[model samples]
Target: MSPFSLPSKPLHLALLGLLLFLLPFAILRERSYVTIDDNLDTEISIPYLLTRYHVALDYRPTAVVPPVMNGLPRNAMRSGLSVTVAVFALLEPLPAYLVHQALVRVLALLGMYALLRAHFLKRDNDKALAAGLALAWAVLPVYSMYGMSVLGQPWLLLAFLNLRQGRSRWTDWALIAGFPLWSFFVFVGPFVLVALAGLLLWDWQQGRGISKRVLLGMALLTILYLVVEYPLLYSLLIAKQFVPHRVEFDLGKLGPQTLAAQLKSAFLYFVTGHYHASRFFRGAAVLAVGAAFLLTPAAKRRAVLRQVLPLLVALAVVALFCGFAQQITDSLQRVIPPLRTFNLSRFHFLTPLLWFVVLVLSLRWLTSRKLQAAFIALQLLIGLGMNAEWLNNLRELAGRPLPDEPNYQAYVAPSLFADIQRYTMENAGPPALYRVACLGFPPSVAQLNSFYTLDSYQNNYPLAYKHEFRPLIAGELAKNAALRTYFDDWGNRCYLFSAELGRNFRVSARQHQQVQDWAFDAAAFQRLGGRYVLSAVQLQAPARSGLQLRGVFSARTAYWRVYLYEVVPSSSPKPGAAVGQKLPEISKFGLLVCKNG
Candidate 1:
């Protein structure tokens, strides 16, 4: 039976929804801050353009350089996802972010459904279980919060769905072609491409042809996407690729042990996220694969498994090899920086895919009672482990009281997250420009820490971190080295919201001195380890002309305030009035600029 043909199963849908709700609730209840890392930068840019300049998504944000500017790579102005949202925004002046996030969630659901229906169509019990598992995968609350901002995964899955159904139409073909364009934008493009290759090859083995029409459809989609997104993508690519490169190193020193450790870390991260969802499911899959392995005449099974598993194996090997060999990895990264773009830890998502293959084969083996029982037992054990891990992590996060030290317990000022959301909402009343000056060094807010900003969270809300803005504090920090410090120093104890009163929002000289002396020196930051890096910046200033004057921001932060200073002659700092204070009553989205400053 085709997956879509399955009768509507109300029970399965309910279970899926429940799983999603629980995941995010658990994450919110446990983790203090929303650690949305990499994509936040994109998020910030889109919203800022929408509000600051009347720049439609079709038009790049005026605050940024156009890709066409001075023969610059077009990607300098926007991102692939940005182009997608911008097009949507132009058609209707709606909040592209909320729409983007919703689209991702929906695509994730559709992808999960297609995957289950493809693999488990005949057995109602298995189908239901697989569907439930898919839902769990889609609604991982932590992933959802991250997804809340624009990212590449949604379209990635959407493209996969197109592949599964087979390109029956031109639109289907268009989307499939467009999938890889994001590969360069978000670092996950290579993995998705590999997955696409595996799927196509799997189909070919099942007696499908490599049709010209399909290839044409793919080509058409690429042209269409490029016409839309090329400007921004091109810019980003070139900027990071100039000769006499800013980052040059040898991968020769990266040894076998480093590769092994990276492999272990990747495996653990994947297991943790998919613990309950993948464990039992993966064990079942492995058994099915094993059965398929045993049943096929040795040679035939070897051929089929080789075709499917090789891609998975190759990707894993590369990730590990790069982790181990800096010279090779570095050389490759310089050529195709996608290798360096993502959190190598995120490569763990590959484990579940590998297990899925195993589970499919194992399910085929479940023809016998003994095999079934063994699979079931394995599933239960994995499920138990996942449940235990979730409980433990939650307990650890909750057990800690409000931090007495600044670094230990710095929550976002009240309504900050909400205010940003409100400001970004479509046609929400009042065009109040807000400039948030994050005081305490939260993982998501800190510029230097990799883990804190892995998925580009700050950018999602339209926050900008220029090259000059990042502290050379540590001279030259390797990406992995930076990531290690972020996790070690902050852990998951960062705050998204806090219960503290508004009056306490003032900055201290001691905090300022610490930020300047210790945090300012990137290399010296470790000595101030576990200490707060108090920094501040605002988004808007009082209008010199009208109530809604354009907003300008400087990169410099002093003491606890992000001083709203005007640029002066000769590179000398011109002091501007302090337009606003972070009073408790102020909305997170509302930056107060005193009328007569």
Candidate 2:
């Protein structure tokens, strides 16, 4: 039946599903702050993005403009926030993270409303049901209590929403999809582009006429994307010096067993909330939906199977195309000529795009009341489990024993991050800038740097491959001297690329000093930009753990040249230098405590 004619039960299911999806975020609103990852995007990157092109600043030459948190690039992705920040800058530096989260929530709700209303909400009962479901989903307590990016997801959702509505040919789809992708190099840009191409190809293969209007629409897509990214794009091309090349991944040589393992990990990734804290419930809910589809009555099933088959085939195609570990590795290597600095991770936004389609199909399957109820029950169970999981996570954050990754503190925010940020910025004098490398650990802190790097974790996910960088990608990145400079290890101001370090940076005062001592000066620390002096004390050890040298003693510190190298060798013969001078060995003992005055 047409979406408009969906029965009461089916409509209820749609709304209920949406609410269920939203429930975690809504219920945990108080706890809702930007996760460290999101912060890296909106909070940290906003200032840098503004300064790069919009505002008059020294604009340090870096690998790319619109700097990123961690390894993720945030250069061209701040279009949505440019105006917001500009307004905030007028008042004061309002926390862009909060703004980002709020905006994302609104976008998510709107997208969900539009999706359900378009697909299921027909009569009064359906509307009520849809509202309930959407709310429940939106605020499900099972997801992380505080995080951002829900809004970002909806931009991609809108693109799919357009496609679902048979308006896939609309130029607006490309523009809408590209907007988010361009803004957050981590989420959906390249994936949306891939999805766009797929839709366009499908239409073309179906013999749909490519009208001048359509071609112009396509041109509009390009124009709009470039417009949004005009500033950053200009920097990369003119100032950054773009290069293009390819990088290779020997995935084919990874033997069948390793390949299978990677595939299983990827599959389990979506099937379970293995990595994502919010969508854990989605796994069981999707399974229940799958079961419901399988159990349909023969006649109804046959009718539905027509739709189901294409969807399943479509899913398989997308999954095969987007799935696998090496896909991302390759995507990062493939560069589009001048856009060498582009990241493949930006295509990850497509995961939500594909999932949106899957969710709609599941909701459509709820045309039957029994199935809808079963699915709802599954959702509720998942939600409950998710809540428990998060609570456990929080408890672990509070110094309780954790079952896994005992480093829960690594991902969670600490009180010190803000203080550290204040100190770093306030103290960093002219030409002395703060450059942080954000990995996906906190997922939110990477947006703080002048330029971010590619999160190695993202090297494994989907849509990650579509932008596969070849020599084309690398050569392009090489051309951008600014982008190259960001990667230079010239400063003491480097942030470790992980969530653990981010949270710890804020929580552990000593660690913060170790960081500062390694990178900045004591005077800079005291006067820290009129902000609090956030210092860390670091005790470095061989990254290779459990190695005990019988004769040699090792001292690990950022001041390697002075502390370790300058020390008189205690009757130890200096080893001959190879192609590279090897770091001196000092770890003879099992453990040693060395303190700095």
- Number of the predicted model whose TM-score against the real structure is largest: 2
What's the distance in Å from true for residue 68, model 1? 21
lDDT of 1 by residue, 114-141 (tens): 5555544346556555554444444433
lDDT, candidate 2, at 398:
55
Model 1 alpha-carbon miss at residue 155, Å: 8.9
Off by over 4 Å in 1: 1-7, 14-33, 36-62, 65-106, 119-126, 140-142, 145-171, 174-184, 194-209, 234-322, 325-327, 333-351, 368-410, 415-597
lDDT of 2 at 34: 30
Question: Cα RMSD (Å) per model?
Answer: 12.3, 12.9
Candidate 1 is scored at a TM of: 0.53
Single out the weakest 10-residue window by summed lDDT for candidate 2. Answer: 588-597
lDDT of 1: 0.36
Q: Whole-model Cα lDDT per candidate?
A: 0.36, 0.37
Q: Taking the tens digit of each residue's C-alpha lDDT, what string does model 2 give over 487-581? A: 22111112322212333333322123322112222122111111111112232431121111112111221111111111112222235521012
